[model samples]
Target: MDYNEDTATDAVLASFEETTDPRLRAFLRLLVPHLHDLVFEFRPTLAEWEYAIEFLTRIGQKCDDTRQEFVLLSDVLGVSMLTETINGQQEGTESTVLGPFHMVASPQRKNGESIDLLGGARPCVIDATVLSTDGKPLVDAEVDVWQCTEDGFYDVQQPGIQPPGNGRGLFRTGEGGRFWFRTVVPSHYPIPQDGPVGELLKATGRHPYRPAHVHFIAKAEGHRALTTHLFVAGSPYIDSDAVFAVRKSLLTDFTESRDEDLARQYGVTVPFVLATPRIVIEPEEGDGSG
Candidate 1:
């Protein structure tokens, strides 16, 4: 077979005939032709291809234990959210991208405890509940929560300033499948923009802002886990999340309240911000992951 434009794709596909793994062979079989067609259609110059290779190289080079530039690159390109959307559950809460910041394990804490290690002028309390699709409360459900600070910086983003496990907690749902926590109201802020992903965003004239929201991962026995967000109502970037993870059903209002009784019940001061969000998960079907 001649290695001309007419035969290049077939030649390359033939070379992978012994790939052993059927899935890999099938994947490459589909990928090679489309990639070759794209190259021929676009006709990128030598220098342009070199630049693209170099850009991907830098994205890999920028990754470390705490930072994930490749995930950020996928996220900015909408691939991450698209993947989550594909495997999304048919019932219960809609899944969203597990953003790069969820790289570490949350420290265990009691219900109604404050995740905010640092004190703030305004405190917000979140009362959360986990339930099955049939409306039964899931007691002892593992509810993991994490969020950025009031200024929109995560604990990992600020190592020296914020202590480890700041703004993160692992809680077990108590009676009525409820878990509560107090923290400072996080501000809507831009995603980290200091890597190859940032360069791509700038080149495309796209903003890197995400809406203010608290991340939640709910898990219980005999049910599929749910990964979603409690998006603050009327947040700055609610309609234009940089990562395209906003769901209207997930929008929760952080209502300001002055009820002394409720405040005393939750061990908080008067005139606090309160957000109540419920997470529902579908029961595990045949061969479903727990």
Candidate 2:
């Protein structure tokens, strides 16, 4: 009974062949081979294996309604973004990780409304148009937007300080395929750092910060839904996203200004930044409802 790494992994994986669940059986069979290969490549000592197991256990222990440590772990490892990219339909804008903070359901708002539940000192307006790749407007498209505050804290992060829907809005496109929302310019911020993922980041000498960006899960009746981010151009981590979710096309401009007339038109005050982003969606051939 030779108990080498390959033999041990094989023996363990062999036990799952009878798993009634197809997903469980498939995952175990695939994962076991990869795990064996990784063990052979790394050749970790007994202590290293124990430490890895403890770290994984701690990640599971850190999950709750508000916090999801395993998602954080996947994010830092680039697994989340990688999985999204691999499975994403290549027709539309590039997809990125949704992150772990979008736990709250966003409240629906009209075509032109404000998601900044927190009254802000700096004014900002986000104007966006939804269009199909064939140069046609896609009306009634649902754009679910969520982001952290200017100070880099999501409403969920500071429940007592921020309202439940502080920086989240679900906007439906108008007949002309247009949507606009009022919000404050978001700032670059770090991912949650009070858990095992943070400890891993610290140990690896990597920063846990993500670039300033607005998340969107946009869907239309017949178009492939896209989960993406409009990353603020020139943000601190635009080049070095801790999660590697930044795409060049998704980089957006936030021009600062004091346009009084424009502010009046958008129902906001002067001295605000304007963010006009047009998301180009390439609906699947059979998936665009006129």
Candidate 3:
């Protein structure tokens, strides 16, 4: 085993032969060959490799309890959405990436209650239903929702300005699998651009903005839970989502209405905007494989 430039890959790979975990061994075995090819193809200098490793190290070091740097790195690299797309459910509704903002537990709230604890003026009503693909209602389903403010900042992103849980809520479906809530219409905003991921975006001439949307995580007893977003129509970055999460089926309209009766029912002012969406959950087969 004479290790040289040509044998560097093999030497590094053989070092992992002593790994006990079968999965880890298999992963390393596959990763080493491809990584070696990449290095050989690029022929990057030692300084270049060192710089890349340091960049990755900094990405990890930037993470903490509230922020996830690795996820941000994956997002900027489009790896998160690609992974989600690969494991996506075909027969079920389309799935999207669970963005980094969903790090905290959403507080349980009554139906039609406003998640905007700050009580700023960007109010709107969201009405949705949990239904099977066969058009049957899924009673007792749980819909967990969170979103950014009208000004494009999440509650966690602005802990001091916004109270905890200012823009998050968990709601249980009532009879007929219906649920509703009140919240400010979130505006489009850029993802965090202060880390290595941001630098990568800048180097590649890519913008870090995400379109306006309300996050939804819906679940029922016999059906697989769905993680998706109802993206606002005509929002910026809808065509160029930094994470590639926008799906045409998930685009929803925030329609304006002057119906006083409907407003009274949802406890909102007349002539308010409403977003009516029907979330279709697919039933899980035996053992829930994949």
Task: Give residue 73's error in model 3 in angstroms.
Answer: 1.1
User: Would you list the C-alpha lDDT of every candidate in the order shown?
Assistant: 0.91, 0.87, 0.88
Clashes of 1: 0
lDDT of 2 by residue, 1-290 (tens): 78775489878887787999999889999998898889889989999999999999999999998899999989999999999989776655788999998888999888668888888888789999888767678899999999989999999899899998889999989877889999998889999999999999999999988999999988887677888999999999898999889989899999987878888999887788899888767675665433
* C-alpha positional error of residue 271 in candidate 1 after TM-score superposition, expressed in Å: 1.5
Report the number of clashing residue pairs per model. Answer: 0, 1, 0
Give the distance in Å from residue 97's predicted Cα in candidate 3 to where it truly belongs.
Answer: 0.6
- Give the poorly placed runs of model 3, Cα more than 4 Å off: 17-22, 287-290
- Reference-based lDDT, residue 207, model 2: 96
| Minimal lDDT window, size 10, model 1 | 281-290
Better structure of 1 and 2 per TM-score? 1
What are the runs in model 2 whose C-alpha is more than 4 Å off? 1-6, 19-26, 284-290
lDDT of 1 by residue, 92-160 (tens): 888888999998999999998999999977889999889888899999999989999998999999999
Worst 10 residues of 3 by lDDT: 281-290
lDDT of 3 by residue, 1-290 (tens): 78888789889888999999999999999999898889879989999999999999999998987788799888877898888888666665677888898999999999979999888674699988988767889888999999999899998888789998888999999989999998878999999888888899999999989999999999998888888889999898899998889999989999887899988988888668799899988878774533
Worst 10 residues of 2 by lDDT: 281-290
Question: Model 1 reaches what TM-score against the true structure?
Answer: 0.95
By lDDT: ranked, best first:
1, 3, 2
